[model samples]
Target: MTAINFAVIGYGGMGSYHIHNIMPNENERIHVVGTYDISGERQKISSQHKHKIYHSLEEVLTDETIEAVLIATPNDSHKDLAIQALKVGKHVVCEKPVTMNVEELDEVLKVAKETGQTFMVHQNRRWDPDFLITRELYKKQQIGELFQIESRVQGANGIPGDWRHELKHGGGMLLDWGVHLLDQLLFLVDSRIEKVSADLSYILGDEVDNGFITYIIFENGIRAIIEVGTTNYTKLPRWYLKGTQGTAVIQDWDLSGEMIVDSGKKNIQAPKPIQAGVGLTKTMAPPSEEATETVALPKITAEYDTFYKNFYKVVREQAEPVVKNEEVRQVMVLIEEIFKAAKR
Candidate 1:
């Protein structure tokens, strides 16, 4: 199989990461031909790394040899860059949030359809090990029927970079981290959202939120809470899944956590009342040792690095994209709804 050649449109943090870390080798299915960045400093850096540096977007677009381009620019620039790449007969791999809003994304999607080029969003969080384990438990019922899921990421650092602090640039935890969390939830649930509510944090006083919490109710009776925090010094579990028969917690990116399930032992010992703050309460007591059994978190076999591999397949062999445009749009639509709900 031939490798699909790609160019980096914006050689910033994420763009640089892609060119260096993601583009594996000559043997891989994807190759980085060069980069296009308005910043001369970034262009110099790209050249230092032995990549062909294009001076302008036009220069990159007109290069008939480059089959695809990755848009790692600011969130607001995603729509125009994606549309231009598609119109020029190049497939596109865009960063998360895809665009500032659903309307902007819709316009890009229209161009992609007209040009018949693959347009896939980099919703890479779907491949996260923590999420993969939870998804496996959801599908296999390793514990039981999972009914509640809490997914979150927290940091003591405020907004990480300059543009991320400004609303015009699509800065904020909602558009930044929120997009990934929501995408993972949507991908895992596989059900229509029956209801939505949200609260965005502005404690840092930026025009955009520093954090946010969104509660989503699914048609299949599953409840999901997605949250992102910039002020949290101590953090909650990265993922918490509750099933009728067991519970699992993925504490951090390291995938630390545990699972406890129904013991299913006949005539298990009953729980005894425990001391409360001021009084004794049986309802708040812990489950008796005989009632539940602790187990290791389920192991998953999916790899997270397959994003570019799938992109190559979609662009070269007309394979269906793992990250579909419609799914990307749906996440954007849900983001819009979250904004409206927060306004209320």
Candidate 2:
């Protein structure tokens, strides 16, 4: 297979991380030919990593050898870079929140169709282990029929850096972390959202929201709560899912969690009422030890295809993209609705 040459724009946090996380080996069918960053300092960093740095976007785009462009710049720049790359007939792999707004994404899509290039968003969270575990549970029905799912990510550091705090740059937790959580929920449920309600917090007083909570109701009778926060000192469980016959909790990124399911056989003895501050109540009591079975989370099968591999396959017309453009457009539309609901 001929190795596809690629260029990366933006050499900041995510851009540099992509170098290490997604770049294929030298023998693979793809390679990062070079990188472009506005900051000389960031360019220097990329040089230190042994990558050639292009002086400008035109340099990268004009290169006939480059088959693809990875746009890892700020959210606001995603649409422009992707459109330019697509216009030049290069396949594009753009970062999430694909564009600041749905309208911008539509423009990018138009260029992609005109150019006949493969365009896909880097919604990498679809392959995240925790989400994969949750999806596995949902598919396997390990805890019976899933009815409620809550996904959250919180930090006390407040909004990070300048671009995220400025509205013009598309700064906000919703577009940041909220996109991943919502995408995961939609990927797992396979249902059209019946309705959505949201509340975005500006407690930190930035131009953009510091946090948000979005409630989504699905056509399959599943309800999901997706949240992202920057001021949360005491965080909630990373994931809490409840089903008709059991419950699952994942505490953090370490994948620490368990599943407890009803054992079908009833407990031989009734549970004693536990004392509360004001009264004793059987309803609030914990289930007897014998009533439920505790089980380790099932091992999740990993689909280890790199973003480039899928892009190559899509370009070859051999397979459909795992990160489909239509799915990405839906997420962008959902994000717009989330922002609107929060404003209301």
Candidate 3:
């Protein structure tokens, strides 16, 4: 296997995470040569991990041995770093929320085309096990023709860092967590989005939103609610999907959940109507026990190529990328539409 030498341009939380998760276990075909970060502290930290520290971005770009660059910096810097790397004839793997806006991503795509470099975004959630399970459920109709999907992630920690609280850095809950949720939806649903409505929350009173709720309607008769909140004292289930014949819920990252579907068994007896506060009703009565069944969500059978593996294959002209530039561009466009809808 020919190893592709890779350089990381940021040493922040996600940058370090990429090293821990992707770099070490990569097949002999990939390696993390070193890293470049303007932060001296981050440089010191990288040294502790046995990774060399580059003096500057230019130095890393000029090195012929390095074949790819990973941009894990703030949202605003993704486009510039990506373009610069591509111009130097290096493939790039940019973090999610590829750029602050679709136009910026357009500029990066132009550079990638001009240089013939393989450019892909790290929309890693596309490979998450929980999401994979949910996608399988939707695609296979395990719950029976899903029509409504609600996805959310909540935290009480508020905004995590300095750059995330400012608008200029492209800081907002929508751009941060929003990108992941929206990307997942776009990947799972094949229909075009017919409408989008959103409301951004400012409970923390920062210049940027702390969280948001986005409602998307797809042409295939699917309605999705993607939400992220920092002010919630209690979190909702990670996933709640409704279908014509049954419903499913995934409570958390642990994939703890179940599906309940009608069993099509006739009731042996009629339900005894219970009185409400002022009236008796049978319409809201629970289904007979024999009429439904609860089952574990079927395990999903899918595998994802690591980000670097795909990068190498694409650069070698051996295969197409899992994260194509056009799909990423559409995600950015949807994000813009979401922002517009929230502001209206």
Candidate 4:
């Protein structure tokens, strides 16, 4: 099989990750041609890793051997780099928050459509196991319909690196981790969004937000709260979802959590009143011990290829992109509205 030669741009954290970890996978359809970066240190590192390093973007784009380019640069540069790559007849795999805003994304997509080049965004978190389990619970109603979802990612680290702390480079939690959570929610919910409310966090005094909390309401009555925090000394559950007949909690990336589901047992005894701060009441007391049952989080598997492998299929076999441009555009649209809502 002839592999599609891929050249990586940026060679920074994510770019370097692509070159070292992602592109060289068992997918025989993808081949790494080389990498390009402005930083001399990164170039030396790339060369040390036995990769051909291009000094300029032009060198990579002009090279006939490279059929596709992965844009892992700063967010501000994605639009221009993607447009240029597509203009040069190279299919593009862009990192998330595809553009600073949807308008810039539109410009890049316009060129892609006109040039007939394949364009896709990373949005890799859709494959995350936590999210997959949640999706299964939501669809299968193993517990019942998920009526409310509280998703969060908290860390003690203020923010990662310098560029992410600035506003101009699209550095912020909203654009950073926020896009992933938003994309997952949008993908999980089939209903249209009825309303969105958000507030960005800048407690760290950086030009960009250190974190944010967004509440979304869907037409089908799904209420979701998506949040990110970089200052939490203690973190909450990564996912907290409430369904009609059960409640699920995912503590963290380890996927340690459980679902408390209705026991469906008749003649359950009522909870005895417990001591309170000053008052005695049973209204706020926990349900009887027999009222609910604890079960393991559902195990789920996706019948889709990994992002790089899917890119190969899309570019080589004319298969639909696992992460489509339109879906990325929708995520961008939600991001725009989120920023707008924060302003209000």
Which stretches in model 4 have alpha-carbon errors above 4 Å?
301-305
- Per-residue lDDT over 8-101 for candidate 2, one digit per residue giving the tens place of the 0 to 100 score: 8998999888778776654576788899999999999899989988999999999998998889999999988998889888988899889998
| Colliding pairs, model 4 | none
Q: Which order, best to worst by TM-score?
A: 1, 4, 2, 3
Regions more than 4 Å wrong, model 3: 24-26, 267-272, 275-281, 301-305
Which pairs of residues collide in model 3? Answer: none
The ten-residue window of minimal lDDT in model 2 covers: 301-310
Please list the Cα RMSD from the true structure of every candidate, rounded to 1 decimal place: 1.1, 1.4, 1.8, 1.4
- State, as a TM-score between 0 and 1, how close model 1 is to the true structure: 0.98
Rank the models by lDDT, top first.
4, 1, 3, 2
In model 4, the number of clashes is 0
Question: lDDT of all the models against the reference?
Answer: 0.90, 0.88, 0.89, 0.91
Which regions of candidate 1 fall more than 4 Å away from where they truly are? Answer: none
On TM-score, the stronger of 1 and 3 is: 1
What is the C-alpha lDDT profile of model 4 across 1-344, one tens digit per residue? 57888888988899888777767456667777788999999889888888888999999989998999999989999999999999999999999889999999999999999999999999989989999999988889977988999999999899999889888999999999999999999999988999999999889899899999999999999999999999999999999999999999999989999999999999988888977889887988888879999999988775434887888888878988989888889999999999999999
Q: Per-residue CA lDDT of candidate 1, range 11-91, in tens?
A: 999999987776655456888999999899989989999999899999999999999999999998998999989998998
Question: How does candidate 2 fare on TM-score?
Answer: 0.97
